[model samples]
Target: MSIEAGKPAGLRERKKLETRIALGWAAIRLTVERGFDAVRVEDIAAEAGVSPRTFNNYFSSKAEAVAARHLDRARMIAEELRARPASEPLWEAVANAVMARFGLTQETRGAGTSDQQWITGLRLMMTEPALQGEFMKAGALAEFELAAAVAERTGTDVERDLYPRLVAGAVWAAITVVTDHWLHADPPVAIVPLLRDALHQLAAGLPVP
Candidate 1:
């Protein structure tokens, strides 16, 4: 039978969401407590009160759980871009959307204790080979989503027009460079300013020397 239009999700959807969330949290908690390599999939599943097969349904690997929190940011930016004023320049639209989704500010800081844990998690992900690979995959997915958003905003065909993909790649590359530099900074540094600098560099369109 055909499903009803706009019907609220029934038992199955809620159960699935609960299961996914449990698995994600379990994976992240384990990874945070131990290094990524030290945490096993079976352990994560058990911690989440699910079977290994259920964990596999939600995430392919433990690395994905750590990165899951950031995945929604790309989709959020895409939605914001889609709603932006048409008069805004493409770069401005994208920049505003991206920053709105990820820009950190002092007002948002909580107990300083949590900040240290977040920084530690980031450092671990940066240093872990498996997690880095997963991070790259997540990045590629974000780029694809961004390209589609750009194409929609610019009235270009995402597949046939090369410009959308090119712009998306350039933007992703700029962010990647900034993030890599931040990870290796001797004294550590704030990401917001570095990301702002990267965005400005893109806006100025300076040729790479």
Candidate 2:
């Protein structure tokens, strides 16, 4: 059934989303504190205050749980971008939509200088050799959302268009680079500005070859 305008999410949908988020955070926290190989699916389920069976409904493996956050955020960003005024510039709209989901702004990072929690989470996800497949798995999960948003911006069908795929790939490549640089920075540089600037550069054709 279609939800009417202004209708809040139904209880079941809310609960399912919350459970997925809780499980993802639990997986991140556990793996960060104890190392990836040390964590297990049962432990993640327990930390999220759910049973193994409940956890299984959301994710197939520990890797998938760890990677789920990006997928969730990606979907949110896609929706947000879709809602932006069509008159807005493509790169500006996409960047703002993404930062909105993270509670970030062009002038501020969400967490200020205290970056340990999330930076640690991202670093673990990016650096853990065992989780490399999971890292790519996360990126893959976000790919469709990016492609669809790009297609929408270009007034084209994602499934049939090359521009959408090309633009989406470029955006992801920029994001990957920014994320890596942010994780490796000695003082934990603010991500929001970096992300905004990266998008701006892309918007400008990245002329500094």
Candidate 3:
């Protein structure tokens, strides 16, 4: 793993994490200010005070940098879910794990970046042909990692057990839809509550009155 195993990040790893984080924030801030097309790789690197080569080392494109936080959330939720007490119900475990990850994003709304900035950037991606495809590709890879974590928690084989894969996929899909709905709402909703509510609904078998 890039962060190493069973130990805190060493100096090198910490610096690398800082760099990637700086670059990601810079990329998002710039693109939010000037749209995706108007922003260049060199601009992201400059904003983060690095060379274009350094930016290339971290992310191949701007969209990947913008989406890095989303990818990290997927990894964090899976790891947290695996660490949740086995005595917890499956859906309960996933709900708590996801909520914890959602809290992480709160502090990261770094300077000059607001809900509107992120929403505008996301909306722009929908219309412009950008590196968002790469972002989705990264998200797909992260989904499988989440499935493996679920499998371990349940003592199920990822290769042989359909249950783990199905649950992981559905959970992520629900999160995506619910998150988009929250973002687009006129009075934006808090994601953590929405996430918890949605997971509870899924746990209840999607029942309606």
Minimal lDDT window, size 10, model 3: 103-112
Sorting all predicted structures by TM-score, with the top scorer first, yields: 3, 2, 1
What tens digits encode model 3's per-residue C-alpha lDDT throughout 54-105?
A: 9999987788887776676777788788779889999899888888776535
lDDT of 1: 0.73
How close to the true structure is residue 54 of candidate 2, measured as C-alpha lDDT?
A: 98
Instruction: Estimate the lDDT of model 2.
Output: 0.77
Question: How does each model score on lDDT?
Answer: 0.73, 0.77, 0.78
If ranked by lDDT, best first, what sequence of candidates would result?
3, 2, 1
Give, for candidate 1, the lowest lDDT window spanning 10 residues.
104-113
lDDT of 3 at 24: 82
Q: Superposing every Cα of model 2 onto the true structure, what RMSD results?
A: 4.2
Q: What is the alpha-carbon lDDT for the whole of candidate 3?
A: 0.78
Top candidate when judged by lDDT against the true structure: 3
**Which residues of candidate 3, in runs, are more than 4 Å off?**
1-7, 103-107
